[model samples]
Target: MSPLLDTLSNAVGAAHVLTHDDPGADLSAWEQDWRQRARGRALAVVRPGSTAEVAAVVRACAAAGVSIVPQGGNTGLVVGSVPDGSGTQVVLSLTRMNKVRAIDAANLTITVDAGCVLQAVQDAAEQAGFLFPLSLAAEGSCTIGGNLATNAGGTQVLRYGNARELCLGLEVVTAQGEVWHGLSGLRKDNTGYDLRDLFVGSEGTLGVITAATMKLYPLPAAQLTAWAAVPSLDAAVQLLGLAHQHLGAGLTGFEVMGQFALSLVAKHFPQQRVPLWDEHPYCVLLENSDNESEEHARAQFERLLETAFENGVVSDAVVAENLQQAHALWHIRESIPLAQAEEGLNIKHDISIPVSKIPAFCAETDALLQHEVPGVRLVNFGHLGDGNLHYNVQAPEGGDAKAFLRTMEERVNTLVFDAVARYDGSISAEHGVGSLKVDKLPGYKDPVALGLMRAVKQALDPHNTLNPGRVLSA
Candidate 1:
């Protein structure tokens, strides 16, 4: 055994460490990512059951100059969890540390171990008669640690905000093997630099987030869902403004999808029939919640639709009658990605611009992409309220997806990112820049911001032992 592996074995015990040649184990799933585009080999996979064990493992890795990749659930899209194929790194799996340390319902907060699955936290909040509203399609499998690391944003961000806003505190294990116990339930703290914010979106480059204290909200008494067919992207944006103007903070989600994307879902998922008057170019899914009666909420949604219809903003609309019906509407919206996946391979970009510029951004980018790549299928859909668009390009008919991807990945990225830059948008909206986008970040990010990030990294991780080659390349 290598000296580093020997030292790790001593620190966390032999059972917690798996060697590179351990064919007896099935680690293929961990080796791949959610997108299956990034794959890597690791020297060993280490599972630590406690924060102390994590600290010890990091100390050992730092001493041996071995890079450590902190992974939770391995459900990330950016290949941040998996190390490079060089097989010189250790995969520190945090799955075994899943636990809810405490829940203070009165304080509207919950402190949970980083390995805790997001759904588990949601269930815990429900058991206490509260709501942990940070939701995503992958909540069932994605861990809270990964959520915090990426500063995850979801549908409800229009109301509750992103993971960073939802988080009140964090318990992180630093690169120097020191456990920073910053977990507090207080809603106000102005001592110094917001260290929690630093590690939340660091993608495991600064530290390993062991646990977090996240804010909770009161469970809304009623939810109203409406699917509206807008005449255009501009109309969709206008309707969103109307929703916010009338609904105020009650408006929870505003998701938009192009007709082509919805058609794919209807084709793939036969049960979810398309519910628009005609094949409109754009559709918006609007969700609202209130403490009053469902009848009142429904009436408010109907009023908005009525106003939109009269003003020619909405071409057609359908409001769900009950909770089950509302879920069905949401099902179609959530199934877009899966249906697209079944269609074929494509380049997926989660880019975001200011909410005001979304329409122009979409119109111009769609034209540019179609012009550049002949017969390209555009699947543009995402949280319109937050301006995050999953602009994906499907291969041409009967074309070899792998061959097309190999030929056009960089070209496609350049086109899309260039458009985002022109619109003052972000290359990565919700997802963090893992190993996949590290090389492309410099061109998009300001040099001063990048320099500050590097300084913070060096200050916290002088040895560059935690998640090396991710987020920033030294």
Candidate 2:
């Protein structure tokens, strides 16, 4: 065994460390991603069960001058979890540390180890008669550590906020093997610099997030789901304003999808029929919640729809009558990614602009792409409430997906990112600047901001040992 592997085995345990040549015990499901970007090999996969064990593993790696890649559920959209083919880095898998240490329902907080699966946390919250409202497509498998690492945003972000906002404190293990225990559930602590926020979205580059205390919300007593067909993106935006004004705090989610994107879902998932007008140009999935009767929530949703229709914002509408029907309506929205995957490989982008600028951004970018790359198939959809969109472009029919991707990836990214910058939007919204977007960051991010990121990274991980060559390249 290599000296480094032997040291890691001794630090954690012999059984906790699997050597590089052990074939890794089949990580196909864990290794692959929703996007199928690329994969890499690790020198060893270490499963540490506690914060102390994680610190020990990190100390060992730091002493050996070997790199460590911190991983959670491995469901990240970018290739952040997977190592490069060099096989020199150790994959520090935190799955074994999955545990809910404490749930202070009265305090409205839950302290959990980073390895705990998101769904498990949600289940724990539900059992406590509360709601951990971080909803995402990959919640079943994605881990809280990964969620915080990426600062994930989802449908509930409009109401509950993103992972960063939901987090109150964190327990991080720095590169030097020391645990920085900041897991305070206190809501008001003007103690000092907000160190927790730095590591929350650092993507494991600055330090290893061992555990966290996340905020919880009161469970909603009622939920209303509606599907509305809008004549145009402008109408969809107008509808959103109306809902906000009328529904106020009850308005939770507002998702807008172009007709073409919805058509793909209908085509791929035939079981999920179109929810609104068959030939509408755009569709909006609106969700509302109230702490009162379901009938009251439904009535409020109906009022919003009625106002939208009267104002010429909504051409048609359908309100879900039951939970099953509500899920079916949401299924159409969630199935967009699955449907796109079934169709073919495409250049995908996660971008966000001002909520009001979305209509113009979509219109201008669509025209530019069509004019630049003839026959480009566009699939655009996402949370309009937060101004983030998944802008994807599939290769023309009969074109080679892989070959097209290889030749046009850079050019395509430039097109989308340039347009995003023009609108003062971000190239990365929910999906982070994992290894994929690290190269493109410097151009988009301010020099001062980038420099400060580098400085923080240097202060926490001077040796560039933790998740090296990711987020901020070495």
Among the numbered candidates, top lDDT falls to 1
Against the reference, the lDDT scores of all candidates come to 0.90, 0.89
What is the Cα-based lDDT of residue 472 in candidate 1?
97
Residue range 1-474, candidate 1, lDDT tens digits: 888888888878888898756668766666788889888888888888999999999998888888999999888888889878888899999999899999987899999999999999999999999999999999899999999999999899999899999999999999989999999887789999889889999999999999999998888889999999998889988999899987889999999998888988888888888687247898999998987878788888988888999889998888888989999898888899999998889898989889899889888988888898888889999999988999888888789999889998899899999999999999999988998899999999999999999999999998899998899987
User: What digit string (tens of lDDT, one per residue) describes model 2 on residues 5-114?
Assistant: 88888878888887645654765444455567877777888888899989999998999888888999998987788777777888889988889999997899999999
Q: Please give the lDDT score at residue 136 for candidate 2.
A: 90
Deviation in angstroms for 270 in model 1? 1.3
Lowest-scoring 10 consecutive residues by lDDT in candidate 2?
26-35
Q: Relative to the unseen true structure, what is the C-alpha lDDT of residue 48 in candidate 2, on a scale of 0 to 100? A: 89
In candidate 1, list every pair of residues with a backbone clash. none
For model 2 the TM-score comes to 0.97
